[model samples]
Target: MSSLTKNLDAIRQNNKIGHFRYTIGVTLFGMQLINYFDRVNLSTAGPSMMSYFHMSSTEFGIVSSAFTWTYMIMQIPSGLILDKIGVKWVSRVSSALWAIPTFLTAFVSGLGPLILLRVLLGVVEAPNTPAGSKAAGYWFPLRERGLATALYDSGTKFANVIGVPVCAFLVLHYGWQSAFFFTAIMSVIFSLWYWIIYRNPRESSHLSKAELEYIEQGGAQEDAQPEPGVNLWFVLRQRKMWGLMLGNFAYNYATFMFLTWLPSFFVKTLNLDIQQSGFMTAIPWLFGFIAEIIVGGWFVDHLIKRGLDASKVRKTTIVIGLSMGIALVGAAYSPSVWIAVIWFTIALTGVCVSAAGFWAIPSIIAPTGLVGVVSSTMNVSGMIAAIITPIITGAAVDATGSFATAFILIGVVLVLGVFGILVLMGPIEQMHPERNDSNATISR
Candidate 1:
């Protein structure tokens, strides 16, 4: 048998969790938790911060966008670094670096300092998604990746659910600054935990021979360390890479709109108080967490068993989800507060449903050694949307005096995203031209 076949056979027979994989997943998940806390703390603190600084809605939007600008610029380079140095130390150091700025945000007395702090936070946090993608690529096989990616990605949604209410309470009780202080402390605690536990799969004491073989057999280069010869031009030239990049940008445009504005939307448009708005904003994310896990694992598995191509399966789900999200613009027009909330919830559910598949696409299309760089490139587009969406939404609110125009705009953009997925995202396989041949061989 070939090396790949031998590895596949070994993996199929091995059912045990190697201590190393478990530790890595746990550490990565914790980092993801901190990542979300640091990012979303700003959203939770928006109301109080706006009042304290006497800032305009546009200014608040700029503060939120600052992180994305830095993050977008840094993603590709950060991915390259992760590929070179591996995930362990990069993740540990980046976690602490971002956490420090988060802690310092508690001391910001004005918009200037707040924006500066957010930019610094973005610089440090840029490596997170790339690192997580690298970890998933190295540790898991094809079949389990969706579930594994969801488990890691779920940390962000979990933070939305848990962090919002907690931060709201802190803002209400102590003040907005206290909320930052609390999240900073949590980041510090998790960073220490990550450093002590994480290890590369090859170096991990817990991984079994069978599991290692399985990963290698599944076309993963876990044992084949990243070499220096990989070039950016090669990755940038691929049609598949562009497809993922554009698709991610569209998805994030919609996702960040909700992340940054949902709480504020509740407060201003729905006439809800801070605590009530926070809780209400969190409900959709709670549903999102459930959907991401279920769709990433069970739903995808069902498609695979039905003999669908992985790319087709992912694209189909995302297209449907984005189409569903387009209704949010209509939701924006609702007269009743409860009706608006329901529409927003449905829209967000569509965004989250497509998320896991988005991350998985990079792994599917990336060259064996360039997974980190490719994933980061794809995520950079999303981060750019993060920067721009807030500014646009803020502008729309300021110009229109109501969030209705902004919601309509966001809905229209989501529809455009569905088009991008169907047209720009051509196929899901890594080697798109050869996918037909692979399928034919499989049939034999």
Candidate 2:
């Protein structure tokens, strides 16, 4: 039998001979889980810090946004670095560097130091999502891209589900500083693990020849470096890229709003204590984690495997998922805590489903040699929203004395995201950076 046929047979027979791509996916997922654990520590500790520092919600918002300001500025550069140096090296260095800020966060005695560390944290961790996207591009075939992307992107949801409660528990018992120390240890360990374990398909002795052939034949970008001249400036000028930016910006606005403010909302709006809020906050993200894995990852891939048009399937998934974000409005008006959790759960589940598809887009659409650049460009938009969301939500809550206005604003932005996806991102196809607006449709 042919190697591809034999590999397919091995997979069908449940022989674990050719599935190392998923190992890569799981590694990326672990990285993101740790990355977000670090990110969510501040949110879990926000109330205590606000009390200790004697800061208003507005000032606290600025502190929370400090991470994204540098994160957003570094996105393009992060992408360039990843593209220039390659994923394994850039990721290795970033993973080690991020631990420093996370560790120092425990020692900050004043707001200035806290903000400076947050900015540094942002600077170091900026390569994370783009690197995951690039790694997925290199490892998985076009057909399996959704699941691979979701595997990692879903880490954000899973982290929120568990990280909030864990951080809160640490904050409640061992003090807020304990949470930072815990995450810093996790980061250091993961940095070492990743450095030792990760290798591209070509370099990996553990990967089977059969699997390598399967991936390459199935459209994995094994070693497709960016063509000599496809720069970030070249990527920025595309209309499709703009659509991606706008859509991702809207998605991330809701994401950051939830990450930064959800616990505060539970305490301030629902009248729950920090411990109760931590557990309650986990419900929505728990549902999000499940939906991202089952719906975004598996179901989308299943549909494509059944011979559905890849573009229509992805577009429909994104639109329907983002449309469900309007449920945030329901949470805003909820009369009881459980009711609010239910609404938020629905909203988050939808957002998570769309994330799988969104993360897959850069790999699917970027011209030869520009996957890293395109992914980072898209992330820049999301980080911009991340910077803005906390500040806007915080100001709204302070001005209105409630979270209702902030929730409504997020719903409106979600709607605009749908429009950007439908109207601006015409077709999910690869573009030629050398040619003016030339798109080559790929057959699934």
Candidate 3:
């Protein structure tokens, strides 16, 4: 009886330290990735869809922009709604809503219905990043927050890595409609799993008291639960906020080019077959996913654990990443397709490294009280890039008869973002509405 009691006690202790929060974090990561798979699958399938509808490059651009328009419109509202209602409901509902439209896209034959369904999908999925950020905050302590944020936030690119190819394969083998069903079925299944498994530390039956106290004591705000009084106007006034917005737009302009146009570029520019384009397209994003997870999240976490100042750590990642992304121009000039893929892979790796830093910053800078509101505002700029880049690139391609000019232009935009960060951006620190915001960083 004594031995059995000791064995039982040891088992309970092991369970407590298993850090189930990491499990929840990774689940959100997977969910956000699946969200983006549904998003960018259209890019991979654009040729088939456009040919089927007898649409030009310009009209396809409109269809691509369809999701982003409503997605942009809903960012602010969705973030606040997630803050109020909590992650569980926001995530599950958003999944169902978007998944339904994704499913319906399979049945739509006309351009009008396709555009409308895309719009609805965007609106419903707008809560994705915001909810993932808030959920990261709830589950992770400060020390773990950066990596956790990066892990979930990198889902977009990570989706491109795996999701694009898989989606492309489905589109080819089973048809474009199958790509839609592939994502929808995955969404429904994951949302159900998330709804059943996820809960806050305080509310969770799986989390132990000792672990809960550890998180709450380590910069996790217990009082940040659903409440009121987030001031968006104040968020808009901060100089750093504007810089983030501008920087987001600039860098994402470059990034969105890949999301919306890369596969098409491969097929049209390099004369690859659909199968070759699908897998080749994933190559750069694969490098991106590796860099983001290893360098942005894991390396930064290692540095902080070694006693480096967190603000410097975050800023260093951002600047270096942006600088490296200038290589995108080289991709255009590469003499061959393989060489171009190498350049793009390098450029995207840089983007991923910096993106991990970018998403983590809002959590650190936003008043703990207003993370959702402020994050929504900053993230809007990224969606604006989504709205702009595809249409502009499509026009540029048609006008120039090649992607050369568009590639150089995208690199210039990313360089402008680098300048924005160096010139207009400030240190990574928590903001205070009551005082001067200029000198926000602390040496620690």
Top-TM-score structure, candidate number:
2
Worst 10 residues of 3 by lDDT: 435-444
Against the correct fold, how does model 2 do in TM-score? 0.95
Could you give the C-alpha RMSD of every candidate to the true structure, in order shown? 4.4, 3.4, 5.6
State every prediction's TM-score relative to the real structure: 0.92, 0.95, 0.92
Candidate 1, residues 31-95, lDDT tens digits: the string is 78889888778998898899999988899999989988888999999988887787888887897
Quality of model 1 by C-alpha lDDT? 0.78
Give the alpha carbon lDDT tens digit for every residue of 271-386 in model 2: 88888999999999999998988899889988887768888899899989898988988888889999999999999889999999899999998877778889999998899999
Whole-model Cα lDDT per candidate?
Answer: 0.78, 0.87, 0.80
Q: Model 2, 326: alpha-carbon shift in Å?
A: 1.2
Query: Ranking by lDDT, best first?
Result: 2, 3, 1
In candidate 3, the residue pairs with backbone N, CA or C atoms under 3 Å apart (3 or more residues apart, or in different chains) clash, namely none
User: What digit string (tens of lDDT, one per residue) describes model 3 on residues 1-444?
Assistant: 234334434554665655878888888888788888877789988999988999877788888888999888999998778666777777877776667899999999899999999999888888888777777777776777778877887778888888888888888899988889888888888777887888878899988787776666556644364223336766676777777777777767878888888999888888886668889889999889888888999899778766688878887788788778878788776788999899889888898898888887776777765677767887799889989888988888888878888888887888788766766667777667564444432222
- Runs of candidate 3 exceeding 4 Å displacement: 1-16, 223-230, 437-444
Tell me how many clashing residue pairs each candidate has.
Answer: 1, 1, 0
In terms of lDDT, model 3 sits at 0.80
